[model samples]
Target: MSAFSLSQALAWIKAAAQSIDANAAHLSELDAAIGDGDHGANMARGMAAVTKKIDSAPPADLAALFKSVGMTLLSSVGGASGPLYGGFFLELGKQSAGKTELDAAGLAAVLGAGLGDIRRRGKAEPGDKTMVDALIPAIDALAAASDLAQGTAKAAETARAAATATAPMLARKGRASYLGERSIGHQDPGANSVALLFAALAQACA
Candidate 1:
């Protein structure tokens, strides 16, 4: 019964924004090895905007809250991540419509839907060494958990591990894909951000 509420989601997003902000430099460094070097800055800006809006007046419903974050990120963040990540949240909102709290199964269903949308929009998959690699496992872990808290924590851990796991994977999507085997040893920026999202949600659930 410890399902995450809109307020909790909002709080988690804000905390995630700050965490992203703190890690912006490191993220940028990571991206510099395989990306445009702006992933960190772009995500930081988008999350900061999301945090500001939520701080002003958080949404009460899941749809409204995620819509707000998605719209804000779409408007603020630049590059491929803006629309991709923003759309991910928007899709999750659509899946969670009318629900204030989601049990493990409910959370899993919504997350699966969200990942499907992201894959459709980004044209990536698990072995692509993109965020999907981390997100897919995290969602699976959440789905297998018995409760929201355990699910969130499992997702967070899975995301973190998957992000690190991506370092050895061959790139199959995004700009990194262009590097082929050369992309090895560098973590995908999107996976790192997804990890942050899961970590934030886990903290909020706590």
Candidate 2:
């Protein structure tokens, strides 16, 4: 558990798929309040693709495996979430190149890179009601945690907290922003998904 492996990463993807599937209706409900009403379905389809790819032929290393997931999700899923989350995982694969197991510092760096990719791709800043708010704080918490398990749990908690905090904030990015002030009082779909991502990681790592 000190370092993540391809199998472990695949396990995370599977867990994330299950989480997304389980929450699909809720995610759709949340998106209907602010978006096109496809966040849940899109994420579920994307993760299902990733799980299928891994089941067919698991990659040899972490980088290849995660990259495969990224590409699969990007192709199989549509909407803003596909490219944003796809880029996040692609950046993670790049950051984790040549490593099977990552230490605490390595985890921080990979998550940082992933967050940067999300920000750049989405052109989002904190408080924009985008995934960046959750991802950035989750990474910060993971960086500060003492161990991998603790770090992942902290990351999940941070994501959940950030998503909740978004309820009162006006959306400034993505489809949610089109709602103007009406966006307030709704949890961002992306932020909720970010929470699911970290929670899946925690489950896999545990």
Candidate 3:
């Protein structure tokens, strides 16, 4: 088994924050095409809070780390994303309670649980022009891998492609859904952000 440490998980959160900050403008631009333009600002702010909270508190275990990330994002971010992402992490924490190390399958289980929370809360399906478009395929790729390194790397790649693929899809959920036909030809910001998250996880494992 390839053991993943708590420090690696912590690194993933920090990298995610940086990725959000770096892509904030891009995210908002994508949102503006089909929904409200505040997605980037809200995500950046929430991720900053997540970074600050983790840096100062330094969670002792995987569950605590996931909880800190979940609670911080829930309170700090605005709009639908806060609850979705926050609930994702909260569920991840719950599933991973008392765990400190992860093999490929172990990591997949926690991440799968987190994605389940997002789907349950948002009710988005594949090809819905939502984060589910990116997340579902990415997790599937991960689940098919033989090791943590390969899984994460493949997941990240799948997520990016899935996010890009959302551009041609008609929005069927969230604020973007209200745009109807006009939502076509625009990428889903939530999907892109989810891609960024997988990228961060891949980076952490690297």
lDDT per residue (tens digit) for residues 55-92 in model 3: 89999999999999999999999699999999999998
TM-score of model 1 relative to the true fold?
A: 0.95
Give the higher-lDDT candidate: 2 or 3: 3
Candidate 3 lDDT score at position 122? 91
lDDT of 1 by residue, 67-132 (tens): 888889999997889888889889888988888887778878987888888889999867888889
Who wins the TM-score comparison? 3
lDDT of each: 0.87, 0.87, 0.92
| Model 2: per-residue Cα lDDT over 1-206, one tens digit each | 57667766878888999999999888888999999889999899898888888889878888988799889989988888989889888988898899888866688888899888888888998899888888888889989976888888888888899988888889999889999999999999889988998899888877
List the lowest-lDDT window of 10 residues for candidate 1: 1-10
Candidate 3 stretches with Cα past 4 Å from truth are none
